[model samples]
Target: MLAKRIIPCLDIKNNEVVKGINFEDLKSAGDPVALAKKYDDELADELMFLDITASSEKRKTILKLVEKISENIFIPFSVGGGVSEIEDIHNLLNSGADKVSINTAAVINPEIIDEAAKKFGSSTIVIAIDAKKVGDEYLVFTYGGKKNSGINAIQWAKEVYNRGAGEILLTSMDKDGTKSGYEINLTSMVVRSVKIPVIASGGARDAKDIEEVFVKADAGAALAASIFHYENSGIISIKKYLKSKGINVRL
Candidate 1:
């Protein structure tokens, strides 16, 4: 069985780690390098670092932070934010990131996914989707949820997979810090829509939330920030609980 992954997410703003509810009213957590090293020590399966403001800033990702975090942690790390071109992906990977995650950039020019997959292979290319529900439709948000892509989340997921995205990191603006749990319906909808690995992000309040994610959504990984950063739960806590749920997770 494929061991499900438990990942810790670091949302960066002004080069500092921050957490917020529904992706608003941010609060400082800690230095990402230190936080990630803590999760590294805790034996986290992987780490995801997102410079949430990069897209809005219309600049490149903070590669210096990527270098710092990558050097401090031994686990595979993926970095995203303000990634606009192939050079950005190349620079991030060369800077020590195991993979490069693109969201707004992918939405703007989905050919970026094809270009990246061809140059770096699908394993190194990740398409991240920030989405929220408006009435009956799930719309993709871009520029760190500041702008709406006007595309349906599930529709874009399938399209990105067709463009050769190896993985999808789908975050729910609806549950982004509610701590209620993963957005199982949204996740399951997209997972069943695409063949690639889908990672569920947002609203992981506890271990049971993660269990519900993998069980109900069939997510390949569950990524959360506050639960891990707030010391409410650790990687081991998540893995142990997932194991108890009969899911294949690293111990």
Candidate 2:
């Protein structure tokens, strides 16, 4: 079996790393470059840097910030937020991002998924889905989780995969930053809907929460922020814990 990945996410805003509960009431964490270096040194499987406000602010992702953070980390790094057209993806990749994640833009012009995958290979294209549970179904949100697109998360995941996206970065807005645990039912729905790998995000408090998602939901990866950012638990310890639980992970 392929080793499940443990990823650290850095939510960037105005060139600073930040975290929040339910995607509101943001609090400063630290310098993005510093955080990136720390996570890389800690043996994290991957690093994801998302410009949390770029899409909402109606601007492009900060290339200089991406470049600076990319230089500090040796592991695979994925960059997202405010990425729209093929040119944006090209610029980000050239700026040193191993993968470019499209959320708002992909919802607006999903054709970009096929276009980017064809140009940069599917492995380089990731569709970041920010979803919120509305009644009985999880609906897709865009523009940094400000607007509901009325798109069903499961259907969108399948569409993204069919359109050539290599992976899905699924985040539950309701569960984000709560540190309660991942939304397993929501995550499992998306994972089951797609043939590609699904990286489960939001509300990770400890290793057991991650283990649960991996075991119950069959998530390809578990992405967390606050726990890692605050040093509540490091990647090494988390990996050790997962291995002890008989989860397949790279040591």
Q: Name the 10 consecutive residues with the lowest summed lDDT in model 1.
A: 20-29
Query: Which stretches of model 1 miss by more than 4 angstroms?
Result: 20-29, 53-61, 230-232
CA lDDT for candidate 2:
0.86
Which pairs of residues clash in candidate 1, taking residues 3 or more apart in a chain or in different chains? none
Model 1 lDDT tens row, 1-251: 78889888887876777763222222423567767777787778999888766445423447777888777888898988777899989988988899999998898889999999999999999999998998898999998799987899999999999999999999999999688998999999999999999999988899999999999999999998767644447678778877887999878
> Backbone clashes in each candidate structure, one number apiece?
0, 0
Candidate 1 TM-score to native: 0.90
**Each prediction's Cα lDDT score?**
0.85, 0.86
Q: Best candidate, TM-score-wise?
A: 2
Clashing pairs in 2: none
Give the true-structure RMSD of model 2: 4.0
True lDDT of residue 182, candidate 2: 97
**Predicted candidate 2 versus true structure: per-residue lDDT over 179-236, tens digit per residue:** 8999999999998888999999999999999999999999999998778644447788
